[model samples]
Target: MNTSATLLDTLRAEVDQSLRKFLDLRRPLLADPDLAPLLQAADEFLAGGKRLRPAFCYWGWRAAGGGPDPAIVTAAASLELLQASALIHDDVMDKSDLRRGMPAAHKRFEALHERSGWHGSARRFGEGAAILLGNLLLLWSGEMWRTSGLAEEALDAAMPLHDHMRTELMCGQYLDLLEQAEGESTFEGALRVALYKSGRYSVEQPLRLGLTLAARGELPWMERLCVEYGRSVGIAFQLRDDVLGVFGDPAETGKPAGDDLREGKRTMLIARALGSATPRQAEDVRALLGDPALDEAGVARLRAIIEETGALAACEEMIKRYLDDALASLEQAPITPESRQALTGLAIAATARRT
Candidate 1:
């Protein structure tokens, strides 16, 4: 089999195993009748994630010369739990109703409240239940890590990375919220947010954590390479998501088309459109950029305006540039040929993902 296929199979197996373990760990807590609402939400929220984060973590371990062991697989699974927790909270914050083609955790709770004719506001019930579910996942994720049986030194070294990932992700999320509220996000600001929230946790930290777990010594050069590669892939992932948010088929993407426009996400494409738009065009674009009231026609018009303004082209060019940078970084890394090839294939696949 080809290298990519092998890597893909390995990752799938590992993630499947990790998910079963995750379900088992939560089984006891979920058995109580009082916890039914939260438990159901948790099960639903975690059921259909693509397992991208855990796959990345697993590949990172393999790329760092680490053999696949139960501990490593468990660590990767822990990352998936963390990802699920983050998404649960994120959907609540974004006021998103659909995730992975179903009602988000908050929305599910709200529906249940309404169906049962509960007294309180359904919105509050939804948000509250989702928050509790998120907290449960966070705690469970930590327990997974603790039970991994890795050395104390390994876990200790990974602590700062873990802390950094959470801090940066939260900071990035806040930065995004502030920018959207202010209606003025520079390219630099958006890039910073993408790197912190997506790039670091999605790529750099996973790679470093895996390496640390394997007791790999200080790899300053390799670290830099990973950051560059991560930043590139992260940006590409977000850019693709932005495109899908606006143009992808709802059936395929599992969300409403043009959801980003409705949410007024200040993406790189949006920033570029503003930069390229004429004075009158700028006003037109700004009017619809953050307006939650925009209908389907309004969204289509906005998308056309962005395309006409040459912003879409600029965004595509930027993605290509980052992919190039990622390739260069991988070429510069001093890992074995096999590891380098695996990383390269992942970079290609990540940049080219249609979904």
Candidate 2:
């Protein structure tokens, strides 16, 4: 296996351990009948995630020369819980049905509602339960971080980044919801959402948090470099996701084809296709933007239009540009060569994931 694979294995093991730690801590709290259901929901929601955010957090800690302390693992695992909360909320907002190869959190709740013969409307109960559980996970993540034994200065410096990540994530989600409702799908609009929703939180903030934890007091030009690097990689990830949403095999991606199309996601692929489409092509896209009733044949036709519009090539080209820039940023960072290599490998793995 390659170094990225090795690091990924290590990251997974560490995150699994940390997750067990957290579950142990929360086990007693879940003993309450009212809270047990919520905890179950949270745990199920977290079940199939790839642990990407926590992996990034750990690599960030390592890249900054932060030792492999159990406390650092605790902090990084907390980040993953935050991500889980965000993802659950995001799925609810997007009205998506599947996530990480399983029913989305809200859907799972709804199913549980029916299976267990809960009293309220299934949809309402599911959404409400998922939302509250997601909020609880976010709160627990923060508490874990605060109690993770970092220095005072480090905590003070890192808190702003943490807050920014949550705030910007929510704002990005709101922007997406607005775009979907209005059908104001544009390339710039999509890119803006990607930046706020993913770029900073996923890439830049994790790296900065790692450095802060190491007590490095912020390196020269770190913010700019991380932003540039993060924006590039983050956009690439989203673009790739857009591609997968349309063209990927369901067996590999673990979702039905055209899931995003059915959801009417205002992604870069959709935006670019709309901008360059002919009148008929444009009409085709507009016709299906949010048509929940669209069947497989309709989805197939929509996929054909999106591909024939050449937006796929544009998206791929853009992904490459970001990848190059991110690698360059890693080279310029003032870190040990080993750490830089590890970070670079992880970045590549993140951008290159097929499922």
TM-scores for candidates 1 onward, in order: 0.94, 0.94
- Per-residue lDDT, model 1, residue 175, is 81
Candidate 2 residue 248 Cα shift, in angstroms, is 2.5
lDDT of each candidate versus the true structure: 0.76, 0.78
lDDT tens per residue, model 1, 1-355: 3586587667767777776776776678568887787766666666675555666666666666777677778887788778888888888877887988998889998998899898989999989988888887888888888777777877787777777776777787788788788888578867776676676777667766776666545455656866787667777767766777787788877888887888888887788888888888788878887676789888988889789988787877877888888889888876767667767776666666464
RMSD of each: 1.8, 1.9
Clashes of each: 0, 0
Best by lDDT: 2
Q: For model 2, what is the error of residue 145's alpha carbon versus the real structure, in angstroms, after optimal superposition?
A: 1.2
TM-score of 2: 0.94
Candidate 2, run of 10 with poorest lDDT = 216-225
- Model 1 spans > 4 angstroms off: 353-355
